[model samples]
Structures are given as C-alpha cells and as structure tokens.
Target: MTDIIDLRSSLANRVQRWLAGSLDQMSDEELLKLVEAQSPAETIAELLVATPTRRAADDDWTDLLLRGAEAKNQIARLAGGLLSSSQAAEVLRISVPGVKQRLERGKLLAVPLPGGQRGFPALQFQRDGHVRKGIAEVAKAGAHLDPWALLAILVDGGAEGGTLLERLDDEAVLRDVLSRLAGYGEHAAA
Candidate 1:
C-alpha cells in the first residue's frame, strides 16, 4: 500500500512538472475557468480556447505533454488491466513492430504509457488470442479523438446500452455505438 502511494505521488509530481509551464502562463481568469470545467477534456478545451495562438514551437511541447498526461491518467485508472506493447504483441502472436503498426493504423487503440511507452487495454483481445470483432472499426472511428477520450467511450456505456467494448461482438450494434460516440465528440467540439 505504501508502495502504491509512493508510485501515485511520483506520477503526480511528474505530471505537475510537465504541466507547470503551461499552467504558469495562464492568467487568473483562465485558471478559474479551468477549475470550473467538469472534466479534464473540458479543462483542456478551455485552456486551448484561452491560448489558441500558443501552438507555436515551445508551447507545442506543452500540448503534447498535456495529452500524454491525460493518457497516463486514463491507463492508471484501469488498475493494471492494460498491457505494455511487448505484452500485447506476445498475446497477439506478433512482433512489437506489428503491434505498433496496428496502433498507428488505428486498428488497435492504446493509451500513452508513462516513460513514453504505449499501453493496450487487455479487454480488447479475447482469451483465445484474437482481437475482439468490431474493435478495429471502433478504433478507426475514434482515431481522431484523444486516446483517453476514446477509452472513456469504450469503457462507459452510452444511452443506448452497454459499453462499446462490451458490444464488440455485434457488428451492427458496434457501428451504432461508434456513431453515437462520434456524435458526442462532435457536440463536445462545438
């Protein structure tokens, strides 16, 4: 338990360091707006809105760091259910490069791991050594969204019913689910 606590503290410290410069640049009003946002995505959207012009050189690093931190938080919340790329590759009976290529092609979804690695959710693969049916479609659908946001959609059920991940066996249902998630993303962006 103490080790877990220490790990959490260490992770938090690293995230704080990554975010420090961007947070430091925010005005009081922007900071207050971020505080008022309901979720991390909303907070990040608010921050981006406040500094649209900050996409220049140095600030680009801040944006990447923020995204990486969000991915790390999402994976951490999964409680070790995610596998490292090497583990995923072994499970899939493929090389690490193949696993990475699948991720790059949006055939598999992954969250950013701490230390600049990527973690694939174990739930996406069956115990029999096969990728869940329709998962590729869902991943392709969510390719434009942040990895954390995509994971949320997969894990949390929408108004229609079960989670996207849970419905992967039904291709038609998965399509509907993916459409609903895409709508949510559009609405959020607007």
Candidate 2:
C-alpha cells in the first residue's frame, strides 16, 4: 500500500535491532526469508525506524519486502472467525435449515453451542467492534421469529431502501422484521 522498498536489508537491520544481543549468526538470506514469510513491510518499517543498525544485503531488498508485506496483508484480510450453524443463520436471518444449507454450500461455519444445547453463539456475528443486538424486541412482540433474518438483514448492510438493521432500536419494527424472517425453520436442523 506504500512505495516499494528493499525488505531483506530492512529485515536484516530490524533483526539486528529487535534481537540486537540475541541475533543468531545466520546468513542474510536466511534471515530475509524468515522475515519475508512473516511480515516484510513490518520488518522493513522496523529496519527503517531502527536506522542505528543498518546492514548491507545482496540485492533489491525493497521489492522483496513490498511483495512479502502485500502477501501478509491479503492473507490477514481473508481470515474470518467461525460461527455455529444456528448462530450463523440467526445472524444472517436465514432459517436454521437455510443456514445448514449454506454451511453445506461452504458459505458459513457451524461451531457447536455451549453445553451442546444446539443453539447459535452470539459471538459469531460480530464484525469489527459492532455486533447485532436487541433480539429481545422480537421476543417481546406477539410474534415469534428466528434471529437469522434480523442478522442477515443487518449483514446485508441494511437492505435497499430500508432494512431492519436501521430500525433495530424500534422494537415494533424489529419485531415485525423478525416475524417475517422466522417460521422458515420448520425443517431446520437441530
């Protein structure tokens, strides 16, 4: 995401600094490969910051570092947390059956519920720092609905013109949304 710079030299420099007294008497290439694997950019940044301990390397350390950093960033972004089948469905507002179908399709995870009670874990739906909440509103209403519908709506970025996510605080509206999303679980897996 930034200008390309030499990585191996940077890494070598960093290892020299971070592990100042403890750096193994290893080859520059060996150290570069290790740094390249973990976080080239971070390593390079470290080296740049720790200019007090610079070292010479074979060739273009900047290119190697940039490639390594790019790779690390992509891999980090692809990783996601796991969720129980029920929790996945509840958060997505799909039926338990629908959630299972998606799981079968490799669309979501199916972590086991606590005590093996066969319910979804709430933690599965959290993204970043925000999480879905206020399902009690639906419970309070006369209608009984599945939690997935609300979650799915929320995850979908709140639908076209409007969605339940925006009105989660409005007990009445949320209840209605939940009612509509519920009852699709007649054939859902337990």
Candidate 3:
C-alpha cells in the first residue's frame, strides 16, 4: 500500500512539473501580458517578502506563487539578450579592455556565460551608439546585488508596474526606478 502511495506521489509531482514547464514556454510578450493581468512584479515581490497580517485566500496564494515563477521565467528570457564582450565593445565604440574596466568600476553589468566568461546585457545600449547612463547609475547604486539580481531589477522594475525597459525614455519612470532600485537609486539620499 505504501509503495502504491509513493508511486502515485512521484507521478503527481512529475505531472505538476510538466504542466509548469509547458506554461513557461509562452513567448515573452504573452508571458508579460499574463503576469501583468494577474499581478505586477513589485506587488508579487512585496507579498512574497512581507509577513501576512491575515490568511491570504488559497487562490491568492496560488496566484502569487505562480506569478513569482513567471517572473523567474521572464529573467531567463532576458538571458538571450546578452551580448558578448567583443560585441558590447563594438556597440559602445570601446576596446574590450575598456568594457572590462567598466565592469570592475560598477559602471556596467554582465552575467556569467558558459566557460567562465562574461556577457553584457544588450538592453542597456541606446540608439545613438551610447550606453544608457541610467544602467550605470543603477549598477553603481545597487553594487551590493549580484550581477543577475541587478539585471532583474533593471529590466523588471518601475513605479507604474510596467517593465522598466519599456519606459526607458521616460524621465519620471527613470527617477522612480532609480529611487526604488535599492530602496534608493543613485540620486537617493543616504
């Protein structure tokens, strides 16, 4: 009887994981739409981190958990947007060594690539052949965070609850995101 129960449990877990994986295969646009329709990243994060004053409804809890998973998947999507060091150097009109110096100075962000190399995020570059200054500010301010965490905060955070990258041109959103990045952006008071 116990063996039968254990077999059933294992099967159930596998089925659940398969379902989640299937849902995670949505296009980035579709995933963002679903996540926004249910809850913004900030709200989901706040709820996950904050101690509850009362019992949340079961549906609410389930939705919150699922939204958190969706956010993780979104971060994974951003991984494909990474640029090789040489590629980044070309984009910014700088030498590869210059790019490395910026990384050491917290003026740029990079994620670990296979074989122990770094890949800069392409999202930070602008149309005029310059990198976004705000990314450097956020990196410098949020120096306490790991590179991947910093990337998530940059691409996913905004005051109005839209993806920060979507409003890269908005002065208000830029201020709000910087102020909110580490509970304080670069311009925030100590």
| Residue 150 accuracy (lDDT) in model 1 | 79
Q: List candidate 1 stretches off by more than 4 Å.
A: 1-80, 158-162, 188-190
* Model 3 stretches astray by more than 4 angstroms: 1-73, 157-162, 184-190
Order by lDDT, highest first = 1, 3, 2
Candidate 1 local lDDT, residue 61: 59
Give per-model TM-scores: 0.58, 0.23, 0.52
Q: Please give the TM-score that candidate 1 achieves against the real structure.
A: 0.58
For model 3, residues 1-190, the per-residue Cα lDDT tens digits are 2223544655566546544554455466655555565456654454333323423235464556456545544664663366778988998899999999988987877876546778777777776758775776777777766666766867775457656754656787778767766574445455
Instruction: Kindly list the per-residue Cα lDDT of model 2 for residues 9-113, writing each as its tens digit.
Output: 566665555454323544576456547755767765544543435453423564466565655333322223234555566667677788666444533323232
Best by TM-score: 1
lDDT of each: 0.74, 0.45, 0.64
TM-score of 2: 0.23
Judge candidate 3 at residue 135 and give its lDDT.
70
Worst 10-residue stretch by lDDT in candidate 2?
73-82
